[model samples]
Target: MKNDFDWKPLALVPALAILVFPFINSGSTWLTLTVAGLAMGMIIFIIASGLTLVFGLMDVLNFGHGVFIALGAFVATSVLGAMGDWTGSDQLWRNMLAVLPAMFVAMLVAGAVGLAFERFIVRPVYGQHLKQILITMGGMIIGEEMIKVIWGPAQIPLPLPTAMRGSILIGEAAIEKYRVIAVVVGLLVFGLLAWTLGRTKIGLLIRAGVQDREMVESLGYRIRRLFVGVFVAGSALAGLGGVMWGLFQQNVIPQMGAQVNVLIFIVIIIGGLGSTGGALIGALLVGLMANYTGFLAPKAALFSNIALMVAILLWRPSGVDPVTSR
Candidate 1:
């Protein structure tokens, strides 16, 4: 295959384009676009991180993950709104402080929901792809309906604390304070996850289980407990992503999760199934492509993302999967 089709040259195209994008569009517009892309990518990464874990470890395609995110956003918004009314200040500090606990609560709630889902919905469908698909899709529908019923099918505005509402001046450009915070939080989460997975005994067990579940079980490891731990953790991460997105974007809606589901799948597909690093790289690529494309063609910015995905699929059907044989 290598002799028949050279893939290395094709791989360089995206890298080259990324290097050249700044030179082509050098201005405030470029900076704004870059920042927006980075922000969006961070959001995607947060959501995708949980997704990659589930897919990698459990081999489960969870359509209900989006619901966790939407729930987190709404939960944080409601809590902060209540705090604002109580304080009568509507200042940044109150809102920021309020959201910290709200996010934690949201994570806890999301984890419980995920645990129930695994117990009642997912346990029976293990090793059965068709059943898993049907059950998960049903879960998605039920989750969406629940969100609509509870939230009233309208978009809710999340109050951004005053501190997060402004932009910071960096050399010649200004970046949104909230976006910077989001990026920092996203990186922190990423780093922490990497450490947990790379430097811990549980992480080793999880990795070994992913490679050989039956063997792990035969070795006396409680696979069921591991699955539950991973599922709950993944849901919590999705919830955290939702909270960050709500705080940064200042809006929450019932369909927000549904709207981003397709793109989330695209990120996972491009990143490689089960690889967190690939998800991160793929998300950044997609984010930057969407932003830079706006400079070249404002109306068709999304087209660039689609085009990149198509090119990737055509060149490497296995995504960023590293295994190759000649």
Candidate 2:
């Protein structure tokens, strides 16, 4: 990593935002869209961060990661469903009480499942990219079927808590309250990840393991265990992201995770194979592009992100900030 911060990639967010401002022509509407885009980006980052970590550190592409996402969403549905009183309340703090527990439980359940997934499904295919892809994909299918068995094959509503249902006016722009919360949660997750990867001893060991596993092991550290930990953490993050995504859509389907897999892959690829910072940039750009294009040309909304990825890859073949260690 460079000693000094690279501001160029950071600048792209604002630059893109500025470039689109003129086309929107309406300040208030533009503001609303920008915020919404940011919120969506953050939720995506939360989900993608785990996969990036797992790939960056373990070099294991667990295609079944989406299963964790779906699991998390379904778990949150049950948790929130049981807390009808709190969700039904108009008090923000009260809603948080219900939401926080749901998030926690979802993470816990996902992490446990991740542990087993690593033990049985992913461990054997370590370092075999082809097998990893094939097996993990099969795992995802099994997971989706399991979800259907448990939650049924129908779409279920996952509405926001009463206090989070409306928008807050800022000047002439209206920002959804849930979007604001999503942004805050995303920022917090980012900050924690940054601090852990940059400042902690465990982080040092993990990064070192990534660069030279043998060297790290020579020092008596168990890099394999650390790698497993990374996998579980990644799975847990996916779960958290699932919960956020489910709420964002206000509905959950058995195949939601697989459907989201496409965007998740796009975000990670654009961010570079395993780069955290790159993922954030890629996600925000995707979110913004999707929103801007959706508003201007609704039909293009589905393809905007694909176009953005191609543009990004064309400009920086390996992504904006690929982890060079790999």
Candidate 3:
């Protein structure tokens, strides 16, 4: 399948931003909200991208994807807490030194746990969608309980490092420094995934396997192992997202992953279940709609994404670009 970049759907992000701009009136406020929405969307994309990959490539329901997210957040909290001196430092580099490790450790730990999860909870239910759903959700509940056992049943504060705590003045707008970081990171992730999937041998194998498992397997490439690797990578991405999310909220809780699960699902569904580009587009839309509605009509904020999803599905039930094909 040659490259068929569905650029039309991407118009939605800028369109939404532009549509909301007039209502916001002030340029600075509009920019501020737009930046914030992008940041939020990036975080959501980080979380949803993994599940999208798994569902698209491995065909696993993975309802427990959120557990990996929560695990990553909690792990980051522990690592960051131990590095008080670095977090307390006002220097941006020093703060990043601390955060970089926290993010790394979070991803590593979460990915490791995901390996076990795939082995025990998910391996048995392969190709069984209903069983996959039931078992993976059970796995998440169990993982949550384990989190409570280790981290306690309370929310733990995840304070931003000193240099990243405040906002940078962008003209009349006050955009957060961390939010800027988030945007950059999100872009980097998207770029990396795009390059890997579009250019690399491994990515080629994964995509081929998705389209025809037997064809790839016949070529002496263990498709199952490739999928396992994909699942692990997805889990790591979720873990990375979890760290960003924890810092974004300045707190962590056992249920945080489960809480965000709905948003994640909405995102993957809105974007084709397997398309990385779609996930990015969907996440940005959801993020923009959320911030816009939250500010415009606070009471209606909760239903905004659901309404958005409904609207999107009404238009394209299979999602923006159902990558399940090519």
Q: lDDT per residue, candidate 2, 105-156, as tens digits?
A: 9999999999999999999999999999999999999999999999999999
lDDT of each: 0.75, 0.88, 0.90
What tens digits encode model 3's per-residue C-alpha lDDT throughout 155-208?
999999999978899899999999999999999998888888889999888767
List the candidate 2 regions with Cα displacement exceeding 4 Å: 2-5
Best by lDDT: 3
Query: What TM-score would candidate 2 get against the native?
Result: 0.96
Could you tell me which 10 consecutive residues in candidate 2 have the lowest summed lDDT?
1-10
Write down the TM-score of every candidate.
0.87, 0.96, 0.97
lDDT of 1 at 61: 83
Which residue pairs in model 2 clash with each other?
none
Ranking by lDDT: 3, 2, 1
